[model samples]
Target chain A: MNAVKKIVKAREFTSFLFLAGLFLVVGIINPAFLSVDNISACFNSSMVYTLIAVGMAFAIFIGEIDVSVGSTMGLSAAVAGTMIQNGSNWFLAFAVGILIGVVVGLVNGWGVAVMKIPSLIFTLGTNGILRGMMYLQVGVEQVNSLPKEFKDMSSKTLVGRFTVYYCCAVLLTIGIHFLLTRTKRGRYFIAVGDNAGGAELVGIPATRTKVTAYLICGVLSAAAGIIFASRIGIVTSLSGNGYEMKAVAACVLGGISLSGGVGSVIGAGIGAVIMASISYLLVFMEAPSNYDNAITGVILITIVVVDALMQHRAAVNNRHARLAARTSAVPGGKEGLEQ
Target chain B: MSDKTPKLGGQNGLRRLWNGPNFRWNLFLLLLITVECVVFGATNSKFLSLTRIFASANGDLTFWYVSIFVTFVMITGGIDIQSCSIVGLTSIIIGVAWQDFGMNIWAAAALAVAVSVACGALSGFFVAYCGVQAMVVTLGGSFLYSGLGLLVSGLSSTEAYKGISGFPDSFKALTKTKIFDLIPLQMIIFLVLLLAAYLLLHRSKYGRKVFLVGVNPSAAEYSGVNSRWITMSTYILSGLAAGITGVVMTSQLGTAKSDLGGNFTMTIITACVLGGTLSTGGKGSAIGTALAAISITLLRFGMPLCFGINKQYLDIPIGVLLVVVVVGRAIVSNPTVIAWVGKLRGKGKEAKAGA
Candidate 1:
């Protein structure tokens, strides 16, 4: 019972429970969706979102926002696709893709952290610049015929039915989760986000931590771009458009506060799985895909409201518990109060 | 960060006024606009003609109208990127209601405004009451509303790409109608909106409440200001403004589409920031936003016409301008940085004197 309570009390655990409940509810509606193959498929489909959400978690953890991730992903994916399609070395193409993310991340960090510009405006500017560069890079032509090895990454299976890409992403997320929760440097992000001035006073390098957070965010987003290209097998101009919002939604669904420093990437990964599964769930329920965006919105609002209400309830309960314990400790105080 | 400033002695009030951030930014924009006109006009004489300038400026009026309202949201330290999506939603609502539901154009517009306001309320509820971050909630709103617009598009007989057209001749003339056979009608509408925005933001009690919330919400709460309602109201106002822009844009373009005004958020934001509105909130002006909008509009159109730059590359300059101006504002507004720059100048002058 204590273990169960502990698991229930952990905030990220609730997100996992929500994910399981969502799948269970959807499975009850369509038994076929409950099949092992279909369920693993959901996790497989979540690879891109999981990557993006994890990347965004770094920024959120550091108490900043990065709207530029979508564009960074797009530009990297386009560059990678173009290079591979042009018969360039795949390894070098991947490196260049990641390098693009690093540069964009550095610029974003410089603007927001070093320059003290608002994160939204600074990232929005970078978003525009990167998107424009993407358009110029892949002008009016779809980059197709990516190397078979790369394109097949999504389909490559792991132990049992899990796909290779998702397996890698899950492990990477778990590894990052440990790094965040257990390491000193990793905790710096949470410390800075919790209270920047307080952290600075405590000998934490707040600015450096924020910039490092952004750099990690950028690199992760670039990696997601490569994975996205592999899965889609074609790079269109609109390939990664509006994805930053989805990633944000996923992180929020995972119980990551936009205010920062409150949730784990593990929760984010779970939330990504939930977010990525919604469209599939809609398909199972025979709803038009056009409803996907509205459903996501509804889900986002509902989850946040529920979380807020839960917090409110918890505070009330704690107060009542404190009163009860105080009365009990006073021996006859409860009986005397009645008199 | 404080409201206090050292007063200059000997009636240097004018110089002190010039040192004020808002005044300085506006003056910079004024000078920039003037320089742009001369350079572009010198390159192409057609650009110098007053008639041509206003005529070219007509399309940008839609962007300027929306930027004013967005400036209000920013002044509260909250952003409404969803405004662009609201434009699409309103346009689609107007189209669907009038064409599909057999409603009158006027009634359809009212319906659009009401719905857009409701969308604003929905997003505002989360940000204001639930404590959700404004950016995240609005980004979700952007998705939900745009998706709703597309869903509405699915209902129209016209294919999505084809868009709905065939408006009454009067409706098409709404924006193009020449005022006194000389001035464009868009100019008149923009001026009216600008004036109204100026009074609402700078001359009203509610405006003070907005600044209070933006500067410090906890402080505002302590002072009995309902910061939640104020934040919510700004978003609602932004939505109504977006609705108006939608009607104007649809009229001006002579058609309605689900994707209309799809990418105008960047331009609106650029205008607001360039207009000297601090993204951190508590400082912005309608006139400044208007001037910034015009400067950007001129830069975008004039560059293509004068230098033969491709229209598609315009984002580069706008993006660069937003970053540069914003960073410059940050540096200039910091007293320590200003003192450093002054010290450097002092050392330079002393070295020159010794030489």
Candidate 2:
């Protein structure tokens, strides 16, 4: 019973329940969507979104945001795609792509963490610069005609009904979650985000933790970019254009507090699945694809409103409990006075 | 002696003027505009013509209009990314109302504005009353409104790509009229709006409440100011501005589409931030935003005309400018940097004494 209560109290549990409920509703509406294959396809399609959301989770955990994730994803994909299209070694292309992410992460971290610039503005700046670089690289053309093996790798599954990419993303999320919950160094992110001054007083390197969070976010986003290239098999200038917002929405849906110091990467992964499945579910429901954005928006608003109201209720309950304890304790004092 | 006294007094007055509120930022923007005009005019002599400059500036009236009211939102320490989507929503609403519903064009426009304001109120309610982050609410609002716009467009017989056109001549005259054949009607409208914004933001008690709320919301609440309402009202004002922009843009382009103003999000934010509005809120000015809008419009106009750079590549410079300028401001305003600089100056004086 205690464990069940704990599970119920966990924020991610609620999101997981929400995800299940969503699937059940969609499945009921369209019996065809209840198939094991179709359900697994939802997870498979969410591989890229999962990686991006998990990456985004780090930023949110540290109480900052990186609006440049989409551009970063686009830039890296363009770089990797161009290199691979030119018959370059795949590993080398991947290296350069990840290198681009690291450099951007460093610049963003330096601006936001070291230079003390607002994270939103700093990332917005980087977003523009990276987008410009992407345009310069891709020009008025899309990068296509990649090797079949590279494209086919996205379909290669390591587990039943799960692509290698999705499996790897899930494993990576679990690993990060373990590290975050079990390791002191990894926990510094939530610590810093919870209270930077207090964290500093306690000898935690708050700035360094923030920089590391951005680095991890950048690395993961770049990885997602490589996966995006392979999955889509074509890279356009507008590729990953609005994924940052989607990732943010995913993180929020996963029960990650925007104010930071809360949530797990696993929850973010779940949220990504939900976010990525919207279009797929819409199709099953026979709804127009144009409703995708509106549905996502509605879901985002609903979740956030619910989260706020819950927090408000909890605060009120805590105040009530405190008051009750105080008033009851006064009876003990009154008895002592009678004695 | 008398001549020297007047000159000295004048010098003192000039210094005071330079130190006045928002004057420095306005002057900086003026200088930037001057430099841009000179360089672009030097490169293309036709650029110096008043008609050409005004025409180019007039093209970006949508940005000016949106940023002017958005300055209020930013001053209240909130942002409205949904404003761009609101523009599209307004345009499509007007198009659908006039063409499909057979309503009067002006009545359609009024309806559009009302709907847009209602949209703003929804997001503002979430941000203010619900205590949700403004960024998340606005981001979601952007998606929601744009999606609604697409759905709305579906109702009309006109194809979304072709847009609705062939409005009444008098209605079209909103953008067509020019004063003295030198200035566009849009420019005059923008000026009037700018003045209204300036007065609302700088002169009114409501404006003071907005600033107080932005500077410290809890303190504002303690002082009996309804900070939430102020914050939410800013979003409404922004929506109203977006509605006006929609009408004017549709008039200017001689058509209305669901996707109109879809790409102006970055430009509007760029105008506000470049004009010296703090993204963290509590500090912004209408005059500064207006000047910044002018400077940006000129830059966008001048780059292609003078430097042969493609219009699409302009984001690079704007991005670099934002990062560099903001970072530079941060460094300059940092107390540690100030102290370090003071120490260095003191050391230099000591070194001079030793020498």
Compare the candidates by DockQ and give the number of the best one. Answer: 2
Q: Residue A19, candidate 2: how far off, in angstroms?
A: 1.6
Candidate 1 lDDT at A338 equals 64
For each prediction in turn, the share of the native Cα contacts (below 8 Å between chains A and B) that it retains comes to 0.52, 0.68
Q: Ten consecutive residues with minimal summed lDDT in candidate 2 chain A?
A: A330-339
What 10-residue stretch in candidate 1 chain A is worst by lDDT? A303-312
Interface RMSD of each: 1.6, 0.9
Can you tell me which runs of candidate 1 are displaced by over 4 Å?
A: A1-4, A312-339, B1-21, B49-62, B342-355
Q: Tens digits of per-residue lDDT for model 2 on A155-192?
A: 99888989999998998999999999999998999999
lDDT of each residue in B1-355, candidate 1, tens digit only = 1223445553476666677547777888999999999999999987877787787786676578889988888888898888888888889888988999999888888899898888888888887887767887887788788889889988998887788888888777887789788888888888899998888887798888988888999999999999999999889988888888888888887788877866787788889988988788888888899999999999887888899876766777788888888887788878898899999999999999999
Model 1 interface CAPRI class:
medium
In angstroms, give how far residue A160 of model 2 lies from its true place.
Answer: 1.6
Q: What is the C-alpha lDDT profile of model 1 across A1-339, one tens digit per residue?
A: 999897688788988888888889988888878888888988899998999899999999888889888989998999998998889998999999999989988999988888888888888788878877887887778888888988987799997789988999999999999898899998999988888889999999998999988998899899999989999999877678878888888999999987777899998899899889989888988788888887887788778877877777889999988987888789898887667
**Pairs of residues clashing in candidate 1:** none
lDDT string, candidate 2, B1-355, tens digits? 2344576686677777777677887888899889988888899997788887788876777788999988888888888888888888899999999999999999999999999899989999999999988888988898899889888988999988899998888789988998998788988889999999988888899889988988999999999999989888999899889989889988888888888976777778878988989988889899999998998888788888888888777778888988887898898989999999999999999999999
Provide the RMSD of all predictions against the true structure, rounded to 1 decimal. Answer: 4.0, 3.5
